[model samples]
Target: MTEPRTFTLRDDLKLALELADAADAISRARFTALDLVVTTKPDRTPVTDADQAVERAIRTVLAEQRPGDGILGEEFGTAGSTSRQWIIDPIDGTAGFMRGIPIWATLIALAVDGVPVVGVVSAPALGKRWWASAGAGAWSSDERTPNASPTRLAVSGVDTLAEASISYGSLQQWDQAGHLDEIVSLSRQVWRTRAYGDMWSYMLLAEGHLDMAGEFDLQPYDMAALAPIVQEAGGVFTSIDGKPGPWHGSALATNGLLHDATLAVLNPA
Candidate 1:
């Protein structure tokens, strides 16, 4: 089979789902294995055997299915053409994953030029998967309804911060990013808050369970898959300073209605 120089949004999305399946097979088996190898990357973040294997598996699949596309993976770094790149986080919440927590997932995204056009977040431990393409809308399925048609996702209608339920990855993230006082003030204004951390927070927002979710110190692999799901679900994804796309160092996602307000609270100037 010949590889096309470009793929349609639907085709890219289909391939992403296939890559997720390849990833889940490896990750699920190593989730809590007694001998799961653990090591640190140059930046001091944890990398487990599952993370390495999942990324390698997905890369292998992409090589077979989309040979011409580029790849930006957490474990393997970058390769190939930038025009049609695949961004992947083999396991988004590695720390929690290594500890037997079920918050980790394989995040796959297809970016055309620099914009994400397809995304798939698959969490096998939680038995849930969410996906979206540029115009196909966001959808999800859980263990209970895995074979059933996915439930379409839509952002909640909570327009006011006073009534909004918010999730910031962690208080320490804000503090470490030199915005501790800002988060403290924002937390006081929200109706409720929790630290849902990683891809789950944005997924919850996309599914209409939360109004806003933001975090600091993120890489492109961490936010690329998430931005499209939130956008297709009728939400907004931007940098903490309101820039577009996932290249920025931080992420601020909200139900469309509350985006401007949330941005104001985070950036007072």
Candidate 2:
């Protein structure tokens, strides 16, 4: 058996971006065609054919380019080595995608030994892409300004919850989690609140447009890509309970200044 070749973080990030390009080609085409076949999953969430196709495209590229790497994708289950895994949400907001909403994106992340080191969130419909590798600053490019250089990203300096603008997924999600009251209290404390939802909220937080974002009932693929971008942008990302990484099934991303304060509000001990 051939040994797996190790890659630098930048090299892996480049490959991730290429994978995003592959995903975008399929996702964007399907989004425009509007020939979607949606079905309810066991969990009662909708999944579209485009989601499967985008993931399959990414997996095919990984099979040829990084055969030894593992994959944990939304459409297909896990495969290969856990030590170096590519976590993907081929279409992070399938509900939005199915409804022709342009908030969806393809999320790709390379996590080494459970720590995400590189991430790419490509939203072709939104005409934007964001990426970062650990130690390299977060960056984004706009399709509207294709000729311009990628701009670096940073989180806001809003230090107090009274001054912080917070975004979340949905009121229903939090209510279902029995935390609706907490989120309501949080809304009262924050300067502003919006249900930007999906991957856009975290990307906005990373860009310093928002101070904080949190949501419940997330899979690793849903968060793996966003975490690195937020962290590289001088923010912090953790489970709502304050545990690090994407394994915790929920997410709370902030400007680092308000993580503890927000955590106290959401998961008070």
Total backbone collisions for each predicted model = 0, 0
The digit string of per-residue lDDT tens for model 1 on 33-101 reads 999999999999989999899998988988898888899999999999758899999999999999999
Q: For residues 228-247, could you state the per-residue lDDT of candidate 2 as single tens digits?
A: 99999999999988999999
RMSD of 1: 1.4
Error of 1 at 157 (Å): 0.3
Question: After superposing candidate 1, which stretches have Cα over 4 Å from the reference?
Answer: 1-5
Q: Tell how far residue 199 is off in model 1, in angstroms.
A: 0.5
Candidate 1 lDDT at 57 equals 90
